[model samples]
Target: MKLTIERAALLKSLAHVQSVVERRTTIPILSNVKLEGRSGRLSLNATDMDLDIAETVPADISQPGATTAPAHTFYDIVRKLPEGSQVEIEFKPDDGQMTLRSGRSKFSLSCLPVEDFPVLSGGEFPFSFTLTSSELKALIDRTRFAISTEETRYYLNGIYLHAATGSDGAMLRAVATDGHRLARAEVTMPEGASGMPGIIIPRKTVAEVRKLIDETDGEITVSLSETKLKFAFADAELTSKLIDGTFPDYERVIPTDNDKVLDVDCKSFAQAVDRVSAISTEKSRAIKLSIERGTATLSASSPESGSAVEEIEATYDSTPLEIGFNSRYLLDILSQVEGETARFAMADAASPTVVREVADSSAIYVLMPMRV
Candidate 1:
């Protein structure tokens, strides 16, 4: 295959596809990207067995053929080339080498047979819907941080995307939890998702799709079956395998009867927790939150290190209550709020805390308390 393409355009597509390729792979072709050149376009594809991404870009094709080349090396060569320079890629089937020429620089990458690349294919998808890029990005950003990194409880390793009843009737909800903390966000349900199956998207797939989504006003077409999911956005398309396990019942964990309310500035509360936690030497990163009448205090103490105390003004009218929580977990839920004030409903020091943005009712977070 031979093609001459603009450096900027090619790099844009390469950047997305190459990221799916893992540096070390038992299969030789898994580390390479497949390039197919036709009459007027070139397609770049990369996959790591479970997930696959393909992006097409405009190119001037001199010879029509296909080959696989090292993904990272090719991407690096294009990225480091002189800005605005046109790149020419030529593949010799006889010698099995791909040559890249740009201005005064040249690079040769070893090529693998395109037939060796594995492409993930899904059966007919009965459910398909479209969502604005911004709306989809919001669901991911708010919940991705709470996904579990624990390998044993693999079911909690990704966000649970499904249709559910929201505060205002039916809506699409994204929920994620790692036992200690949970995040839930809802969006207006789009059409054609009524028959969609609840699916657990793997953490890696969520990350790759998030990277491909840009700030444009384009709509992404999402299609999914029982075992696979596809996202077709702009010039790129992604396919991934669904995580195969039953997600735990999350509704039972959310508190609905907690009435002790406290309203405080989200930024101020997060900053205070960060400062107090700096002196906490425990692996749990625990910090105490004491609220009474109209003020709240945060304190952390470590026998080896020193102690810290900070008082912040809050709007609370309940009896004095002291609760201990992991500083990292508290800050994580606070960072998702965009509004100035955060509302916290506590039921004592033993129960989970309910947190939400005062002005936004579409998202809610739950944090489990820890022993100080």
Candidate 2:
């Protein structure tokens, strides 16, 4: 490919595309990013055989051609160039080298045949809809922390994205769980989104897609089929394979009969959990919450480390309750709550507890207790 592109634009597109390329891939072509210059534009593509990203940037194309070059190396060359410098890239078909020239600097990189690059096909999508960037980003940020990392139960590995009927109306819901805790968040369903099939978006794909979703307020077109999903925004598109497993019935895990209520400031609760966990054992990392009357005390004890205790005022009217939880999991769910008060409905010391914001009803979280 022969093209002259602005350095800043090329670097921005490379930042999004090169991350999909593994640093030490076994396949030679997989380590390289394919570049195509055609019709006054340049296209960059990279894939890891599972998730693929393709980004296009405006360019001045002198000749139309295609080739593959080392993804990170090419990115570094373009990144180190001075600000506002224009980059000139040409593929020498005779010797199979890609030449890059900027200012007085000149470098030639070995290239592979572009035909060897893998393309992840997003088969036909029966359901398609549009959502604002902020809407999609909020869904990912609120629920992504609870995605399971265990390899055995692959069903809980990613977010369960589907449509649900909420108290407000039809909603788009995202749920994630790892046996210890679960998070469920919903937003108003955009137009024509009720027919989208529920799918387990793999953890990696969710992460990569989040990087592509910026902080803008523009609309993004989403298309999904049985086996694949695609996110299209701006001049970039991401296509990924869905996890091939059935998500467990998450509704069964959410507690509905809990009556004991504890209301506390969300920031203070998280801070207390962080403080007491300092003395917790590395293996268990458990912190116990002892609630009585109107006060709650968070305490942790370990054989090697000393004990830590922090008390916070809470509104609890039921009998004295003591529950244990992993400090990290407690903070993870609490951080998602933006309101002033975090309401917890606890059935007992052994059962799972339901947490939600006192003012917001769109998001609910369930946390399982640990043995003190």
lDDT, residue 38, candidate 1: 97
Lowest summed lDDT window (length 10), candidate 2: 209-218
Model 2, range 1-372, lDDT digits (tens) per residue? Answer: 688999999999999999988888788999999999999889999999888999999999999999999999999999899999999999978899999999999999999988888879546988889988888988898899999999999999999999999999899999999999999999999887887889999998888889878624588898999889898988889898899999999999998999899999999899899988999999999999999989999999999998999999999999999999999999999998999999999999999999999999989999999999
Per-residue error for 197 in candidate 2, Å, reads 1.4
> Could you tell me how far off, in angstroms, the CA of residue 39 lies in candidate 1 after the best superposition?
3.7
Model 1 lDDT vs. the true structure?
0.92
Superposed by TM-score, candidate 1 places the C-alpha of residue 42 at a distance from the truth, in angstroms, of 1.6
| Model 2 stretches astray by more than 4 angstroms | none
Relative to the true structure, candidate 1 reaches a TM of 0.97
* Residue-by-residue lDDT tens digits, candidate 1, 161-189: 99998779889999999999999998999
lDDT for position 336 in model 2: 88
